[model samples]
Target chain A: MNLKRTTLIPLDDDSLAESIFKSFIEKEMMLLMVIIGDTDTIREAIPKADNLAQLSYFKMERWVLWVRNYEILSETLKKHLKASDADKSKEDYNNIKCLCFSPILDKVDGIILKNAELSYASLQQSFFKAQAHDALAVNI
Target chain B: MYYLKRISTLVLVCFTIGIQAQIISVIENDKDQKRTISLTDKQIVDINSSLEIQLSKLQLLDAIQQQFPQLKQHLELESKLIKLQQALRNQSAVISILEKQLATASEQATFFEIMNGFLTDIQNDPLLNERYNDLMAKFFSTDTFAPGTVPEPYIFSNLNNDMLQIEQELASLEADIYAVSVLAFKKDSSGGDRVHIQNYDTYTNRDYVTIKRWVTSLSTEQKQQLEALNDIAKQNNLKKTNVFNELKIKLLEEFKSITCIKDFKNNSIEFINNIQLNDVVPTEVKNKIEQLNLLITRFETLFLLLKTDMDQWQITLLLDIKSEVETIVTLLKTIDTNFSDVTTLINQTRVKTKFMPLVSEFNTCYATINKDFETLKQGAALLFNLQNNYIANKAIGTEVLAFTLDNLPDKGYINLKGTGQRKNGDELLIELVLRLPSAVENAPEQVVTIEQREFIMQLTGPRSEVAIGLIFANPINKEDLNLQNDRNFFYTPSAALLLKFGSNKSHFYNDFLDFGIGLNFATPDFNTDGTPEFGTGIITTAFKNIISAGVNYNLTLDSFYWFFGVNLPFNLPGIPINNIKN
Candidate 1:
């Protein structure tokens, strides 16, 4: 399925980055992919994400990021997320379980999550399911 | 002796008869003559008694003549004695006849002497001489008297009546002369001989010493008689002069009185005219002028009988006075005209002085009010323009949305476009499109339709430009947004620095619409229970660079809940900040 959504955010750089980071965390993904311009803050955040997954960085005009399994990120990494590119294509995502966070995502096939659809129960359900699957796989 | 007595008695009888007959003829022939002799009763008896004595004596002589007729022989010696007695008788008769002639001659001489004295007295006085000649001409012109003939005693019979008439006229004439002399011949109080007659009428209790002297000099009577005569002549000359001086003083008074009246009348006329021509004449002065005029009019009539007697000086004076009166009348008329003109001019000046300042003040007030009215008119017109732009722009937003919805496309991408121009040089090109989902139940399988709307607004003329602004979340409500009670609400307070490119229109600092920004703060209290809302959003207007309206949008639980309402830049009520600009 192809899905698209748009959101208006505050003009402040910190608030913009927070909005992008929050969307990324809600998706519960592992393998992280990033597209960023040549900036020092993004270069530093790339090494920190190695504990969750192998980091791939591409130099571009706008910021774009992808995560595979549920992993919590540090606040410093979230503050730099506003540089993410929002208008990306479907061919950019390699796996079916990938979660993308951007200002705008066009011609991408996925389930759209907005403020209306993200309730407290849905977030808790996603967190527990991810935890249960991880414990089961590790024991086996 | 008896014969002698008888002859003498006869002779006396014949002589008496002859005398009686002559006397009777004289009395009978001149019956028309006015006799001066009026006999009394006692004189008639005395003459009759004397005639009786003569008749008795003649009877005695007759008896003696008869007894002596036989005694002729002794008559020689006796004739001598008788002759002596006859002589004595004849002498007695002659003596009686002479006595009668002597009485007649004595009466004639006494009458002539009295008349001659009266004429001499009149001729000797200057005042009387002039009038005596006039009177002689008047009286003798009617009587047939020879030149130098003494008037007969018969003419004197009417002397008292003539003198009475003359005295009355003289009295009138003297009174008139006294009045004139009172004005013209004033006696100096200082006892100087040089007389000053100016303003003589004002002198009181004056003694006319010069007139008295002139009167006394005209007569040679005793001092007492002269004084009495002067006093009588001055006091009641009209009554007493004819009796005392036998019409001599009366004629003198008449002549002088007539001459003086003529002279004083001319002087009075001149005096009155002078008074009338004075620049300022009091009531008393005017009264005096009228009195003098009356005196002249009366005296002119009174002196008419003396017209032939008027001297050259009197005629000249009258002519001069008439001319002077005419000149005074003309001068009075000129003065009256000038007075009327002066009164009118003063009134006009008074009115102008009283009202001029008030008129000037009124004009000034009118000018000030007119200027204020013009300013008010311009302000009203500016406000009207702002109001019209606001209504038109708001209507365009709502009507365009409704029109686009009415022609919605069916489940496909459809585009609508419109273009218009605003009065304040703003141009608009609106493009709208509808995108509908293929199926709502497909759940994440189909892409959600996106609605696209674009408005291209630009300035189309000079003094026209668009203002750019920024919108932001309000700091007061930034932390209050939560899902429990503020699920679909947000608020922002914004500030914008407006830039107008290619236009010279200035901006107001407090006007949010000019900057295209406003403050919008709202909370859950503003919305209905269970109803989701987008809260209030206030936008500054760019129409003529003024702050205009605000919009509140609300999205309900099941649909979009919103409405359009007007807003002010400040938290004040009513038609926003446009009123302040005006």
Candidate 2:
């Protein structure tokens, strides 16, 4: 089956990301995500963002973090793979990777994650891609 | 004024004519005993019932007369009792007055005779014997009887035969003392002991027993005095007896006079009530009488007509008058054997030649009186029937007849019931019922094999609707064993018009119509293998098809809370539901 992703805008003073996550839970889907620290917040110098609580089925520690600039995307990926021990020489790394990130449109991006699995490198890469798309759309 | 006077004269003439027309001859023999012959059904019924009632009354009277002498005597005494009572009163007064006088005079005479005897005794013995001398001395000394003195105020004292004899006591004294003295004492004293020497003892001892032993001689004057007093008393009693006899005779004569007049009046009323005097006779008889009377005034004309006519019709018309008079006389004789009909025959003889005038006179005599008699008879019959014979108000007479149809089995029975009369009307009902075990539920429709279905049918015909109504009264006591049975009832019920048909026994069934509904239940019978072939449940469906809209009920007796109404079925067959569980 072909996979597709849909984004929801944050409501005024409301957790639009959490609402989307809850819709996934009602459909009994396996994975959910929320993007934080995007270009809109960096350019405006805003800090102290709220985080959604992780349910028992999904842990907050598995969430991906990303920087905003496209130039840092390669650098962010290189550090993430090292910290995740992707260079452990001959070990199989495909199943160990729990997530991946892809930029499809200016403020839109894709985050792929394995159901009920986690990895350090996949989280860092997905985070950096999400931030780049947010910065690119904010700059325009 | 002239017209008014003329009118008055005319009125006076008319008033005289009216009086002349109403001049009813007080014929002693006339009586009306006419019977009404009615052709109407209602009148026929009334007359029949009236005849029955009168016959019963006559029977009662006859029975009383036969068995009770008091009743016969009462009838005989009833006529003369008033006069007899008056006579009895008069006679009783005379007898009582005469008796009072007789009683008083006789008592007086007795006292006088007694006084006379006493006076005689005094005169006969001037010197007096010892006893007489003692008594006379005592009598003269006592204040009550002293000589030449008034005796006891009410006491009688008389002098007799020129002797100063007290008539009242002198006779008694002589008889009492002298008889005893002579019997007891001899002429010479023979006894050795002298029992009495004092005059007082001789005078005081006057009793027969005492004197017989104490005295020896008696005086003849005393005996004569006693005899005369007894004769005087007897003569007084004889006179009183004559007076009583005379009073009794006088009373009887007076009673006879009043009773004769009363009897004449009663007999006169009874006679007038019996004969239909003014009743209209046949026109033919009237014409004949008229012709006979006319013949005398028209003798010359009749003689001229005699040459012209020798007609049998005219001769027969004249003969019919004689026959009609004979018939009337015969009828009168049949009613009262003692009636001579002499006045009728004499009147007919005087008018024998004046036929037309006699017919008019006789018709005039009987017609109005006949009308009056008819009115009285009708009124009396109505009054008596309504007053005494109208017993249907509260009196209920019931008669029940039960008959079983022979065509059915022994278990099957039919009863024909009839009630005598209740209140005022008659009611009739009939019921046909069939009771079978619940096993019949599984049986085929044609499985009515037992002879006549062993059913029981009942019919009740009563005289009134207020009486017991048509009802299916269940008598079964077992709750588990439901004994509801199939019932088919039909008969004409009580109603004004229907009750008339009930009186005619043959037409009773023809006029009556009825319909009924019921339920049936029972224990299911077992098959050969002990399996119950029939199942039980409510069997409420019912349908009745009659000429009218008969009724259908689920549970007719259950307060009619749930029922099925059958409305106007036209020639429909019985609708049965065997499988209630279905």
Candidate 3:
């Protein structure tokens, strides 16, 4: 699959990334959005971005992470997973919450998103490159 | 409104009244002796009930006459009932005519047999038989049809026509009022208003698909067990279809095996919720399903909180889930899976959502309708009970069927006309019949009945009487001796007012040997020239007041005198014997 990257400016605020989400649909792509950042600004923007995302099997898929403290968030999530798995009533096996952040987005702050150059002539930055690669993998 | 009630008792009391231990006073004709009647308990009950029924009819009629004067409107209402009956009768008559015609047409359906009879006669004659055989040989052929397989349902041969033509037309018709006139109680009518049942949108007819969520996680111990389980699975040639359950069972053998949280997986939550629980879905039910699905999703996260020992929100969510599930379960259970109509669906939809209130509503509707129906039923019962008679509100007459008598006391002359019958030469039965006008239920009542009283009676006879008289004094008085011999005695008026007793049956004081004392007014014969002055005196009565000889002394006259007379209202002298014969 050929990979392409898309960059979103004005990301350092508690505002919905409507333009980016709309762009994915305009570019004739599956409606998938994965927001990744480790900042207070990113944490506050989760609900703001969530308002724009239609959460339904027939609608769109959303994977968001507003990592305040990476260790605390990861441990908290792991603890939940461990405890929930122990609970038979939860039946969490089918409700597999995908923690997909391996070869795609990294623990970059909102400043990186704001500082990333709009490479109109070139392909994209590495972070954008990784997002495009993730998007392409989803398309395949 | 209750004018007709208990008219039976009124009729009974009018004639034979039982005073002592079921003994009835029945006056019968000596020769005819209509019926030797004894009032048995059952017979009394029957008579009372029948009389009550009869009298209720009469009373209703009278009440309808007096209270409801809308006779013309009532007759108009009756016209509807008459029309209904007429229509039924007319329909029956038409059906009868149709049946007769149908029977006639049935007999005419043997035309083929009639033709065969002629053909048989021809064949019986020898000369014709030869021609008939020749013709049969020429015309008659094999009884086989064209060779083709019969259709699965070859019904053409079974469609035998009756060939009886029946034509019907309306010769005469009456379509005005008689065609239809019906009366029935309806809501929001002239008398009072009634409400219509409401239609709720959530009364679903479709069965909702259940949404289930599954949890999957693994611990280090379960992961270690998975290798052996996988080996076992490979030995059994097991796959996802069969081995998952075994794997799950194996995983659960150890505690804290977060490896496999469940043995089953159903990822149809999003499928059903998106496709089915949509726009056309029953809104309230849809909302509940959506809310429940939301809670199940929330429980997944809440489970995390519960395990993490964040107690507050988890407990609330669990309680909410339990309550909401109970509500939905009860509601769904009440739904009839096979309801034939919308009414049943709505009724079922209004399940025990709020257990107390909903059940109370059902009971309320039932009780209200029941009470109203009972009222209407009582009214209809009353109307039907009024079969053929009208009881009277007021009854007045001079005489009735019978009279009873009591034995008189022996004190003095009672100044009454009494007839007594001595039974077995021991007990006396006095027939106290009077030819005076009588009344019942307050209509100027008068019963001139004199109980067999003693010889002596109170002067007022249980009712007050003021007596007045014209009197003449004798000349033996010292004051009157000074007057001329011709004017020695003077004409004067006398009067008395007496307080009476024994008037009511309850008062037995002076009941038999009756006596009365009262003050009187008379003349003071002081002037010797035949003029007298009037003054007061004291008076008394005796001998049942039968011989009321007026020999009273005058308190005003201050003299002793002799006189014979009567009267408070009118004065008459010299006519003795206290006569009240009128």
Interface RMSD of 2: 91.5
Give DockQ per model, in order.
0.00, 0.00, 0.00
Model 3, residue A36: displacement in angstroms? 99
* Top TM-score prediction, candidate number: 3
Ranking by lDDT: 3, 1, 2
lDDT of each: 0.30, 0.26, 0.30
- Model 3, span B300-394: residue lDDT tens: 34434433431222211233333333343333223212111222332445332322333343344334434433443343233222211111101
In angstroms and one decimal each, the interface RMSD of every candidate reads 98.9, 91.5, 45.2
Candidate 2 per-residue lDDT, tens place, B1-582, comes to 999999999999987644333211111110122233221111111101111110111222233344445435432322122222221223333233324423343333333333333333333333322333343334434363422232212111111111222232233332211000100111112211111112101211211211111112245875786577658757864655444344334422332222232333344334333322424333343443333333322432432242233122131132232333334334323322222232233245433333334334434433443343344334333333332212211111111111111111112111111111111112211111112223344331221111110111112232111111112222222243342433222221210111111221222242234322223222222112333222111222222112212222223222111112233333246632121120
Model 1 per-residue lDDT tens digits across residues B463-490: 2222222222222332333234343332
Q: Give DockQ: model 3.
A: 0.00
Which of the CAPRI classes, incorrect, acceptable, medium or high, describes model 3?
Answer: incorrect
Worst 10 residues of 3 chain B by lDDT: B45-54
- Residue B347 of model 2, lDDT score: 45
Which regions in candidate 2 have their CA more than 4 angstroms from the true location?
A1-140, B1-87, B90-472, B476-481, B484-582
Clashes of 1: 14
Give the poorly placed runs of model 3, Cα more than 4 Å off: A1-140, B1-464, B475-480, B486-490, B503-514, B524-531, B542-558, B562-582
